[model samples]
Target chain A: MSIKLTIMDEMARVAREHGKILAPLDDDLALLDCGLDSLGIAVLVARLEDKLGLDPFTTAEEVQFPVTVGDFVKAYEHGAH
Target chain B: MSTALTDAQPLRARLTGATADAVFFDRAARVRVADLVCRTSLCGGRADLGGRAVLLVTASQLTAALALIELDGMVRRLLILPPDVDPDHLGALIAGAEIDAVVTDGTLPPQLAGLPVRVVCTPGIVPLAEPPRACERTEWVLLTSGTTGVPKMVAHSVAGLTAALAPSASAEPVVWGTFYDIRRYGGLQIFLRAVLGGASLVLSSAGEPVAEHLARLARHGVTHLSGTPSHWRRALMSPEIGRIAPRYVRLSGEIADQAILDALRAAFPRADIGHAYASTEAGVVFAVDDGRAGFPARFLNGARNGVEIKIVDGCLRIRSPGAALRYVGGAKTAALHDGDGFVDSGDMVERQGDRYVFVGRQGGIINVGGLKVHPEEVEAVINRHPRVRMSLVRAKRSPFTGALVVADIVLTAPAAAAGNEAELRDDILKLCRGALPRHKVPAAISFVPALAVAATGKLARRGV
Candidate 1:
């Protein structure tokens, strides 16, 4: 699967298991405005790190946290490249 | 004047006529009573805060802070504010307490600059004025380690606080050290004990690495050292633990689990390693010196010195002449005490064979090391996220800190579908980091379908 697809799938799984998402997934959505919280986000990151074998937040020398869904995906994409 | 008024000696009477040299030693300098007296007189005169509410921001300079405390005791109602407190929160505290002056070491936060309180920055002597007469009833207002909301101000009289302290055992003045800062209750107890006993104190600097702190204690030949279990754990982890050979080692602030007690015994076989049960409200309750985790069960309803202890419905209750008079600006004295005057300690104890062990807090407060963290406070912050339906904060056992904070969160459906949980978590953490102190930050975050609620319509905290 593509990195974007994998990240999305993990996010959906975490959300479905913990809380319900009333709207459609999109890049423009502010992550904080979404239903997920810090713990849910942490689970998603751990899943992504497991599959991709890279955690951008932990491995990066200086990590600027991504505020939006698009920026988050971009962070993973940059790390992958 | 009443007999009590005439009988009450000035608070400075504790420090009067001590041997003129090496009274307080830190990494940088040695302070004498004469030096302290002169400085105190100069500060008292310069600040001229006569019987006003004075907020003391120690900023972890133990020597200067102690001197300021001595001065405040003489002429002002001292409010000891922790050095690590958030500046904005501190401003609220200062305003709430109606502080008239501030004595600090040149590091006052910008938020407090505009306050009407007189600011006396330390290490410089101002021109001296005639010293004012000390009050017969000097109040020392301390802030409770608020885990849920704003910290409460607890008022204690100087005489009542020092009433229970035992005189120094040895004729030769001993050297004392503690892991707590002078602003904190536990550290203040040690400071008062050292002063009342006529011993010199080695004050630990805040934010100094544990290895360096331990090295300093060793270099200064600290004979009696006291710390929380967490502090000891950090000290044990340090490579320089072998440097200090104290004659007495004490543990307080957190539950003294068997593992920590055994570790201390192994580390300091010759030292009298003991753990004490004490609180800001209850003063020093009891000390267990048997290298055990819990006190004997028989201590219930037992009187030690002047303090009495008993367990009420699994909660430890204490009645002492030295107990804090009342929580200032908050709860009344009646609300905290029983009909007979025993203060509800808010700590839950469990019966373990012949001993009673402290399990945790009954009031849903999480103790991370010796510091208190309220779950409601963290939950309130997490619930602010637009997508979050609710959040539950709890403590998980940790080796580094005694307990690590973890948050379980429930999200809104649309946000869940967005599949951006990682980013959401980071954002939430950032929000908490910006708002809460470092120790109050949640170490781990996890997603939950729902938070359990009790049958009585309250959030269920059992088995967390």
Candidate 2:
């Protein structure tokens, strides 16, 4: 699976576990509007860290805050380089 | 007047009794207290280790207990060396504590090759031609597990060490057991409880399995049990925990969360469960026995038997005769007390309505963003999960918030194998979400087989 799918799957899983009804996973969908809070985002990052064997937020030099789902996925994809 | 006990008198006078029964035990030997009052030596022949600074590095805690009973007022200073002290720093400890003589189990580590005067302490007694004469006073020097470098050595008078211990409440012979080595402060408190409180004590052996230790405690009819919450958590997880029926259970060295307290209550329905607030430097501050987590606010009332307490900027400060006099050799972080004589315990506390809840230590804070989270605080919430056995919350370096809270948790045996661990994780996370603020809640938790508890019987709060 591409890193984007993996991130999307984990986001859905974490949101489901948190009982948050996530908005449609459009690239332009704002992360805050996806019904996930900081804790959910944290869990998503942690699950990604486990599955991907890396935490882009920790590894990337001065990674920007992801305002949208596409930005979050791009950060991880950029780190994969 | 309390006969055979008061700390003001010499241990030679205190251990004198008509009883022939053994008062201390280990995996190998049993020793009587009153018998030690008479002229004798465990090292064979006469040991001239009196009226001078003495280093007690006995391999066996039983032997250490014996040394303590025999040399209380007979030595100018008695320094207890726990098994975990850095050998490289042994020479420094020797000079810092003014240790001139050594007592050991004949296996002195290479660190002590410099000390010429040595007495080998084994199990059996040697017929003594004459007992070592008593000194005017003996200062008990205990090494505090300092933050870094060589541990700081603190001096305590016999009265100071025993001031927190209550007199024998009754003559009933309740054999005591602890999961602590008799060298550290927590262990020494139990040692003093057994000896001065007029009770038999079964000592813990290092590396012994929880089941085996519990069985041994059962074999000896251990009724009063004491240890840190970490020790008790490990013991409670063992199937053999049911083997021993204790009348009293005590926790110290770490904050006793409501989860462990409630678990202990369920495990031993009839046992009197209590936890105390004490430190290596501050001695014992107080004990709470109401089957509660934090202590009642009333403990802050007027002086209770000369022990004064005040909270200065969220830290608990205690002033008592039981507090250690001063740190020997002026090691860094050895500012033992303020000019007002209050030893500032670095333990942080928060007032919760009518109770004082211990948050965590001053230096143990985990910063998440701009907010502070105590690992113990996060762990206390996670441990409340029904399937959780124990948890260790810690910090993970995070580019997002400088540092993020993470937890390594051990689940109950059944839950571990049930294989629905994902659900348990979600359940635990939900618990954290409910009880904790966003920053204090763990960002993630990893299921672990076990958490490492240090020799100090505390959850080793280091990187996972």
Candidate 3:
């Protein structure tokens, strides 16, 4: 699966587990507006790390915390490359 | 005990008005205090194991307690070994403490096979033909918990251990209970308290279920209870928490945060909630009984004997009469206290408003992007959430930051949280964000069925 799809799927699963629904998985959606809380985001990051076998926060020379869904996907994509 | 050990004086000669109420209870049997006046812990083997460094390894705390009472003024030095000591460190501890005799409960572990003398205690009240007589003042040795390889053995005089315990006035029948094994420092304090007050003590086994333990305590009508915050947190989660409504609830061996204090207050409405600040190396420090989190800043004002406190490099240092006298065995250095006679307790604290609240251990900080995060600080914040039953904040290795703060938490109600994990997680995150610094917030939080509490009744910290 693609990194973006994998991230979105895990986010949805985590939200369901938390008894909440996701707002939307659009690339332009700000992370703060996502149905996930910071703990949910953290759980998503851990899940993505297990699924993708890479952590952009650990691999990339310089990294910034993502502001949007697109930025998170791009960071993972860049680290994978 | 400082006066001098006499042939006529046993340890309990200090307790004057002892009626027939005091007894020690385990799961299997019970021994009354009045019956113990004539009987010896080592019933038959007391003759062979006299006047030497005696290592006591008991299967039951009941035996350990009775043996201590009998061995106080009879032997040269008596080391009470907790059942959970690492076997690898046994050889060194035996040789270092110069253990020539051992008092055990019928069975001896293979590690202690080479000891010169082994006496088996049955926790019975049978009179011995020739009971061990008091000769030398027995120095009591205890082991400090070791995170790495081996624990240090601390030596204390009988005078030192009982310095802070004032004899209980004959007011009401006070039956005591503890989650701690009687061999450890905290539990030993409670044992001494029971002995001093001529009261009964309900002992806890190592791996006993919380419900069964609570039921047993209720059966005994336990009135005074003491344990670590971790023990109380796990106990509060059980439905059997209402079984025994203790008149006094005490917490020690860890920092007592605001959340646990409040929880105990609400659960036991009529009980007086108190958390004592006692160090293993340092003696018993001051206790906070005002239902507050940390002690008042004014506690540091007076330079008294047992209550003296000084903050050197943020670590709380104390000089008290209740501390360990010296380090036994040659495993470590000779100094139990500092040059100024103060035991430097490695707990760090911060002055917030009118109180000095604990942050974390001095060597227990997580360096996250050059910012120090105290695990206890994060744990205190995480526990404030209503959904959290218990939380252990730990450092997870991270290449981005030196170490990332992560938390493993147990839910107060697992069945009630089937689909409501997201809201609870959100509430916890919001609480942490408001209370803790950004770096101190957990990078990841996982809901575990239960957190592993050590044999010391503390939240076990796994390797980072």
Candidate 4:
């Protein structure tokens, strides 16, 4: 099943906060790279942790993913269970 | 930062008093609090508890309380664990060790649903409890392997530890920064030195952001920074290194070379970049800083008798005041021991005139077939280049060669400058071939923007 739109919105909010423009979720998520640096990704993960109340990404490799907003939402949704 | 007067009078006086209330743990205000803890523990009835009565809380407030316990003579044992440790493991360890009373934030270990030890959850309440006396020497125990493998308890004495701290040179007030776990010995030294000197301790919010850490140094006006060679290299590569500066930079827990020293000097022109040599078992050995990259002649030409260092069988042997009593259960015995007292660290060394330089750990020297290849030796060659910021050389399994040297590099310049992966590969290979020995040269190179540095700013060599 696909992720909820609310997750996409929150992901977008995080991307925007990190000074990245998020493409629409309808597009291929992998195509839209937000170019989030380490600190930016850290902020995104922290926000997601607070929002989801779960530590989704612990390792550096996991955090390096979600190059784009759509990719982030998808990853979060996939791991939501 | 500021050595402002505490709300109370001088700490020595309160420590001497029958009843004294003071802040026990503070990352920022360590020296004052440590001094207070040391004084009170020594004078008060609790002096005997040494490591046992002391309930070491991971939180700054709890650490403060533990410091007070250390002073009050109430602490009979010390349970050293990081704030982030698994509560289940902590409780199990505490229970297995039979900790008398726990001084924690009432955060019960998941495994410790119900324990017999009295729990002191609040700092406000710790002071109110009847003054617990000091614990016995046999009670001083530290977690065996840390987060790795199974955890065991290693016992130490207060006099042994106090003796450990006393032999080292007195620390001057400086900002103490590190990337190692606070629970680990490496991290504890930084904490100990800061508490001893009362310096501001700047912890990394973002793990080892060398640039960000340097900025924090500027923000907090931190004077002293400590870490492994890898950490120092990160700080050197940090764009902020050229921008902000620290007063003193110390490299420890690993071998440091000229390349790292040169890079740090380039980054912090005004700072005193040096080496602080020590081990987990050996508390604080002699530190070598020649105001340049290589080792110095015992700081002042073997002037201090507290630490005596020599090279035997091409290995570094040292006897110092801060050396540990003995390893509890480790296979390795007193390294390079003379009949009388001195201990060898099982590390090879090269003598360049008076100063002795560390070559590599005896255990780590990789045997590629028969030729011995030290990882640091290969790393130093690669790191000498201006574009290469950091390099980790490790032996990789190879079907043809048995084991070939592999280097993972982080560049100071953009990766695209080499045009593409193939070209970058060729260029680096050519550079290594021309500069290094056949066996010493890396067979494979992976250009990464940054290498994975552990929290204590040391290179993570295991997974790589």
Pick the TM-score winner.
Answer: 2
- Best first by DockQ, ranked: 2, 3, 1, 4
Alpha-carbon shift of residue B7 in model 4 (angstroms): 29
Error of 1 at A39 (Å): 21
Clashing pairs in 3: A18-B422, B283-B322, B283-B323
Per-prediction backbone clash count: 16, 0, 3, 31
Regions of candidate 4 where Cα sits further than 4 Å from its true position: A1-81, B1-73, B82-101, B106-108, B112-115, B118-148, B151-182, B204-215, B236-243, B296-303, B329-340, B415-427
lDDT of 4 by residue, B1-464 (tens): 11223232222333342222112222343223433433332222332333443445545433433343353223444556554555545555656556655444445554544543434333332232344333233334555333354354544443334443432243444555655554556666665555444444665542334576577666666666777888667666666766556777878877777777887777778877778776655456666666654566554347253766676787766666655555333422423246756666666777668776666767677666567887877787787776777888887653223455778888877645566766665567667767665666665577877887654346767631
What is the DockQ score, from 0 to 1, of model 2? 0.40
lDDT of 3 by residue, B362-432 (tens): 87898876889899999999988887888999987664466778888998887888887778876887788
TM-score of every model versus the real structure: 0.66, 0.92, 0.88, 0.65
Candidate 1 interface RMSD value: 9.3
Model 2, runs deviating above 4 Å: A9-43, A60-71, A78-81, B1-7, B44-47, B414-418
Off by over 4 Å in 3: A5-81, B1-10, B130-132
Q: What TM value does the first chain of each candidate achieve?
A: 0.89, 0.91, 0.86, 0.53
Per-residue error (Å), model 2, residue B425: 0.6
Residue B396 alpha-carbon offset, candidate 2, angstroms: 1.1
Q: Candidate 3: global Cα-lDDT?
A: 0.82
The digit string of per-residue lDDT tens for model 2 on B228-296 reads 999999999888998998999999989999999999999999989999888889999888899989988
lDDT of 4 at B37: 34
Top-DockQ structure, candidate number = 2
Model 1 CAPRI rating? incorrect
User: In model 1 chain B, which range of ten residues has the least summed lDDT?
Assistant: B453-462
Docking class of 4: incorrect
